[model samples]
Target: MNSLRAILLGTLAAGLSAGGALADGVVNIYTYRQPALIQPVLDAFTKETGINTEVLFLDKGLEERILAEGQNSPADVIMTVDIARLTSAKAKGITQPLNDETVNKNISAEYRDPDGHWFGLTKRARVIYASKDRVKDTSITYADLADPKWKGKICMRSGQHDYNLGLFGSAIAHWGPEKTEEWMKGLKDNLAHKPDGGDRPQAKSIAAGECDIAIGNTYYVGLMRTNEKEPEEKEWGNAINVLFPTFENGLTHVNISGAALAKDAPHKEDAIKLIQFLSSDEAQRIYAEKNFEYPVENGLEPSEMVKSFGELKADTLPLADIASHRKEASEMVDRVGLDDGPST
Candidate 1:
């Protein structure tokens, strides 16, 4: 996924930084990912290479910030969750192509940008949360979510969100727009209530017997079970069992946490090294274990608890194909008023 390199000295030529000495052994990062989610990987990178990692956590506007800063942007790397956001950074022109052999080799062709703009670090499956008491089925499929049997028994978050859009995109990729649109309509018709909350809240809804099943990413269940501050969430975690829902074709849908090199990085070499290290097995283990996500690299396993959910046979529908359809997916959500619950 490598491309012709950008001008390595372009930022310096632009007189960026105004003649101040560039800091040695440091890589500045702007990330949309939560700090706690990535701290271990960053800390490990610094410990191994003696290079300091400076992260600026941003809830939003990571690309806009870099674009606004232009040649003076101190961001050496950009980290974010979801293929939609990662592709957003590339489409916004804030990321440069990476030419690292390590990154190209470690990341799969489907998970990394064909142009080498971004590489996925970890993956989380979009799975079903079935209430232990009310939902007796041991196995389920994504297609079943729309079945009449589950009418008034299903829960989910807003359809417009990236998480749901990614899942919707996969459906579109697998079944085509017309069939996928019909599928969305069926899913909307079966909603237990209006789509109004985050994935974890869907589990809480299930716990309260508001729905027999809910849609959520796999990691949230682990996060809830281990939460110390909100111990009541543990009950939500315990009340439902994680069910890796598959397509009728027998494959689950998953999304990624990925990163890109800044277009005007001040520490290009160090930033590349950081990306390389993160792709290594050691860093990947620490990363996936800490977050209960699956390593994007092949052959590496997820944390034990995550594994306890069940093995995931992920749908090979290329994420690039799915991402391309997100706009239509969102539009379909509004067209059907999916967030307004099932229309009687």
Candidate 2:
């Protein structure tokens, strides 16, 4: 906590020690990510490269803000969650394509654009968590989450969250708009609680006996397990079991939190350098463990937290499908009226 505070304070003040500021690099980042989450790769880059880094961490609406800033934006790179943010940035022409071979080689074709527009560093899967005592004979797929028996027994984060949007996008890719919307409506009707808090809170609610099931990314469970301040987190960890839906019909839906270069970046080279560095093997390993996520590169073991939760198959569906259908996915959330409180 103290170290994270120092990093935040230092970055906010741009208060580099007397000597570091004179170096050959300063990369400004617009991050729709928490400071704690990205600090590992950021600090490592600075340690090795002597670059001064400045980050503006905002939780929501980074794309609109960047578009509003235009050329005047001081940001060199923008990092965000899910394909929606990355795709929207590319679609709006707010991102610069990275033509570097190192990035192209390291990130997979499914995780990035062939045009080198953006790159994925880490992956998160949206899978099912059922209270061991309550949910029997777990369903085989996300489609099964909408089963009539599961109605009023599920806990999920808000529909507006990017994670849910990406999952919806995957559904659209497979089932088409109309069928996807129908599924969303059914899923909403089955929702046990109003959309509130993040994935962890939904899990915590399940642990607290407010719900019997949760739909969240794998990492949140990892994070909660490591949360030192919340002893209840231990019980939170104990309350549910992970079930990766591999029903032989299709792959599970997953999403990524990734980075892209600014369209009119002021420090273009540094931005590319940072992206390149994050995609490096060392940095990716650090990201995998520190954030409790899966690396985009092959052969790295998933973080221990993910391992503890259980093993699962990732949906091999191309990520672009998530971007293409983000709109309809969101509309179904509103249309289904799944806006009840966290635990009903």
Candidate 3:
């Protein structure tokens, strides 16, 4: 009887040591997005596991915050959108590598780090949005956003914005700095308005008849169409249509909202478990549907609003290249003096 009791205790101790509950009480999530965008997923996670999930939401400077908190940070996971943001976090050493096979299989190789430090949950294409009445041509490419024909007719956010920086980095990766900077010069010269605001404002311009073609994300349209509370939002969405450009050689430009486990997480094992759950097929799909984003998981589609945009050939560029060329992109942004990032 003593031998059997000893064996049971040994098993219990093993479970406890691995952080399988009893000791793990909370999961702290640090998110760059506002709670409105991330809360539903957190709620769903809590509902499924009965584990308490808490988020420290922010609109900006989240990366600096994590780095500032350093080892003492209460964060268990860092969630951010865009390759630049994801790479910056890892570069700052705020996170450690997470090389689980489950994440590797569900998230696309192109969207994740080779070392497995971070994994993207959803996809947003940096696609072209053209005013339905103005853009009669269906063959425009991203390069065309810089065309002289588009001068004073293009609407874009600021070059310093992560999304634009990611796009610029991708361009530099594909076209090199000299050529990419030339393109930026031309594109900046063509802007209808100063680069400013989120992509939504660009779409709003299309609805208000402010521009002809807007370089924006496909998912933004989905968010508006699916959840817009105002009739004007419906109008804003209805005024524009999506175009997947440069599919002949390259896919559309893409970015992600990714998560990485904290390096010094108090509950390291539980943090890994939560990441696994978030990167799993079930969670990816639900998050996509709930947030109106494309799942990075293979063979999955976003909500109906996204699918309705029709099939797309995503930019096959590795996300790393986008982050790597950010310095050059920033220089180009300054040289061209594009929209100063929303309301410039």
Candidate 4:
């Protein structure tokens, strides 16, 4: 870990030296989100507030990178996907609590940290993609995925992937470790083949009749449907119906792409302004339209392509509660041999 941190810091220092020092009017960001996914909102923020912004995109180790930079870290704000990543940033002590009234007012309590350590910008449901030709059921529950009736009729990516962990974590929050473990075992037994590939491939598998149903995020459907470059992806998107599955509590499981105020921020005020703007209606709309994610702010409609997935009644369970169980959920996955697929 130490060597890796040094390499990351060394690479960053070289890049920063070449770019020269950032101006006082700028807020530097270190993010796990891809640059293109967030550029529109940042551009709008600069236009509206006249505060320049810089982004450093990282695929992983965002918290570790900031930690390595320490008090001298140039990061003022951190943006990333998943409740787990957001909460992990806070837990790593790289984040400071943000208590802006505008942010608190715009985002709901369920989506924000109770102590204001992080805030959700958008939501995506962990939904079921059912083959239109093979599946007759219009509605299903997370628990139903384990039923013997669907044996050899499901496909999913690795059970230990962060996305699956988030969903399984929510199950642990709702059902506790024991029942959730049994459900994991049962679900494992129902797999059509060894869990493999990303969410998009699960859809492609459905299109090829490898499985009747699969678990995936809501936005992948929109992405695949709109992808002109890979026209085959459009066929994958069209092969299935997106179903909003619920827990026994009657609410859909959702995760977030969210932001946090970085600790030791050099530009604290501008960082706050940036975070506040993200929670604003304008930024929320931009997020909805560009990313096909449900805006965290109330009364904002998702992109039209997303709306066609039907109404999402997201579970009122605080994401923090779900995040709390992620470690245990991961442990259960290995314990049940979930990623090893079904037994003979």
Which run of 10 residues does model 1 get worst, by summed lDDT? Answer: 1-10
Best by TM-score: 4
lDDT by residue (51-164, candidate 4, tens digit) is 888888888888888888787778899999999888889899999987889999999999999999999999999999999998999899999998999999999999889899
Candidate 2 lDDT tens digits, 293-330: 88866466776667886666677777886777778777
lDDT tens digits, residue span 182-213, model 3 = 88878877787777778888889988888888
Ranking by lDDT: 4, 1, 3, 2
Question: In order, what lDDT does every prediction score?
Answer: 0.86, 0.76, 0.77, 0.90
Kindly indicate the candidate among 3 and 4 with the higher TM-score.
Answer: 4
Which of 3 and 4 is ahead in lDDT? 4
Counting only residues 3 or more apart in sequence or on different chains, how many pairs clash (N, Cα, C under 3 Å) in candidate 4?
A: 0
- Model 4: lowest-lDDT 10 consecutive positions: 13-22
Worst 10-residue lDDT window for candidate 2 reads 15-24
lDDT of 3: 0.77
CA lDDT, candidate 1, residue 299: 85
RMSD per prediction, one decimal? Answer: 5.5, 5.5, 8.4, 2.2
